[model samples]
Target: MNATGEGEAAPRQIEVLASVRGRVMCMDSAYDVDEANRGRDVCVNSSYCGVLPARFIAEHRPRAAIGMDCGVGPEGSAIAGLWYLEALGIPAAVADVMTAHLGDGVHLYHHGIVSFANQPALDCGVTAGMAVREAAALLLEHDPVAAAASEITNRTVMETTPDGRSVVAADSIAFGTSEDTDRNVLVTAGHTGRSAVPYLRRCRPFGFICSDGGRGLNDSGMAGLYLVEADGLAGATVDARRARMGSGLSHYHDGIISAVNALAAAAGVEIGMACPQAAHHLLHRRPPTASPVP
Candidate 1:
């Protein structure tokens, strides 16, 4: 993946993307696979050129995988994950999406469908533009593993509004728990998608700062609009390059505002504004949380 269309460097480490049935889905660039990641056989990678760091995969091989295609840039050599996994005798796929997505590459999972799959994935019926979840389902059906928490999911309390709303940073809405689920101003890394609504509904925050996942435009980026409808929660999006994994929630305090909903407009969250500035604006419009059926 060439550096075009991207702004931030991908995370240098791996993080948990999901955990089900003792099988964990992990996200990372390229790094040595230590005992900490021993059983993480399902992986989502961020490295554009993986030949050097991807050597670690041979030792801690994931049975199935997903990753950014890096737009097939620089003579298409940036498709590192696909090439590496193919030789390792595993099912693997890479996104046909933009380069910005390859940075902190997990965003590619949220926005992309399978554009390219190695021999193993093709045998399982994985194809270009197939929804990511469907691809994951195929992977889980084939292989599984587990690993310890690399650390706590990255999230932060950036500011407390004068009205007492807590503004926090988080990578995914999965962190949205019943304990601290409501009336929050969340700076998050998840994309805006209807498929993601159920997850955001769990968090049920008062406002959001999310990544556009490098596909921010038209209907593809309307997930946040649908999200605000859940409870009129003001929301906005940034680029994947500006944020990665949990850091997408905490790392990019200020960056371009890509999209917004009408209520977010009423609440002062505008499209095209820097996120830090937008977060500042929404602080004044804090409204009491309305009960949502979801």
Candidate 2:
């Protein structure tokens, strides 16, 4: 029984279901875009992915946020948005699988929702299976002013691919500046945001693996978008859905894009291909791939 209608029979539209103290709860039948959710308290996002959702928090700077986790499929990419928001020091959470969508949760339209919460959200008492109304209530209990957290950590080298190439994994794009050694492989949990291109250009890695970050409304064309635009860099981004790395980047998905550079193309890479296979074609020096590239 929200402003729209009753639960299970509500129409899909961008409606301000509730608002208070410049902090409001809003809903969009489609997705939670920044341009659409400026002063919202809780965002009832019907969208199913987290891939670039945090961009809005970075830009417009909302107080807190909530959305659907989209089941965090494949490589844990969907919830990457929650991770990013938490990293940005914002309290964010998402609805679980059984309760997300526009009208499919514990009644986000009426009550609050409690699903997957980031560390920041948890710190503020946001918990899973809680009502969205309850979650919003907890958010209101905290100071409205935002806090500053630490910057994302640098990329760390997890392992070598047995063929002598280095596998560098980090949370940010600062890896290209490593003066340690020579290794052509790079992996990161960060999205392929266009801003990372310049730093990566200065710290070139022949092959790159990045996170897609759920490709949320604000993130659709940004992840790895610009990095691939540059020349001579063979790149692939793990579906943010499958790019979850709680233990670290060792679990990065090995899928590469159909798009690649001239050098990688000449070495036999193709679109919609596995990143490991693509890397084998370009950076594999000593040991050969399964079939050996002829």
Candidate 3:
């Protein structure tokens, strides 16, 4: 029993109930919207089959999902929700289904089964489910085992602007054993040429480490490299890159090695080469473009 004299259930139970509630609510709301929209369309078509309706169905209809914001305008909000779940000791696999609400206010709604093993109840403060009193009770009843779960999955929300593109970054630490440490490498695929360049420039002799094959740099003109001292990455590299780009969209070809370097420099840490062949193969395939010798 919990402080409130109620029996505490497992986390899995809480998730199951929440999932059921979310699903039912979502379905009912969607059905109502469809019915209203359908009725309106039928009326319009009956009135004038040859001409378009005065009001289009999309213009007057509400979305099927009440709290979801899947449009471009809400991309940042969606990403934020994903990060939030990750910070709570949940892995990305479980966090992906959570939806973000961006109407008049912002909120996250979990629509999956609540299980002690996977979707544990949130600690007391979260107001996503209901008022604190009800939310706490529900959580305790559903996911009592959460208290014993590992906290290593904790994460932090970060806002990053890569090449003038604003992105809500979710940063997490992934540790490795001695056996895996020697093979650890930082791998990033290039959508723009600048992706791997900044790190190479900042690391110098150590440079960014890469796998021997570097097969991951599939994009044309893309490059990849490994960080020799993964521990020494500070924020200097990223800052420099951001400064160079200014306000407008960054050129696809400009590598942002400098920005990554800034992050490494700021952290006062260095990362080791985990995969040299992968880096070499990628860089070799799309060698950095040359500028006229000054």
Q: In TM-score terms, which candidate is top?
A: 1
TM-score of 1: 0.48
What lDDT score belongs to each candidate, Candidate 1 first? 0.61, 0.56, 0.24
lDDT, model 3: 0.24
Candidate 3 local lDDT, 179-232, one digit each (tens): 212122223222223344454443232112221221224422222222322443
Displacement of the residue 26 alpha carbon in candidate 2, Å: 2.3
Candidate 1 ranges with C-alpha deviation above 4 Å: 1-49, 56-151, 162-164, 216-218, 288-294
Q: List all candidate RMSDs to the true structure.
A: 14.9, 11.3, 18.6
Sort by TM-score, top down from the best: 1, 2, 3
lDDT by residue for model 1 over 1-294, one digit each (tens)? 323545654444445445552243535554534444444445666554345545665567655666666666664576665667666666677766652355554565555566777656765667777865567667656542222333334556777867576667765666655544656767777677665677667777767777776755665754655555656566777765555534544435645777776667777777677777777666556575557978
lDDT-wise, the better of 1 and 2 is 1
Higher TM-score: candidate 2 or 3? 2
Tell me the deviation in Å of residue 270 in model 1.
Answer: 1.9
TM-score of each: 0.48, 0.41, 0.24
- The residue ranges of model 2 lying beyond 4 angstroms of the native Cα positions read 1-20, 29-32, 35-40, 103-107, 111-113, 144-294
Best by lDDT: 1
Q: Write one digit per residue (lDDT tens) for candidate 2, span 80-118.
A: 777777666667777765554454322544554566787
Clashes of 3: 68
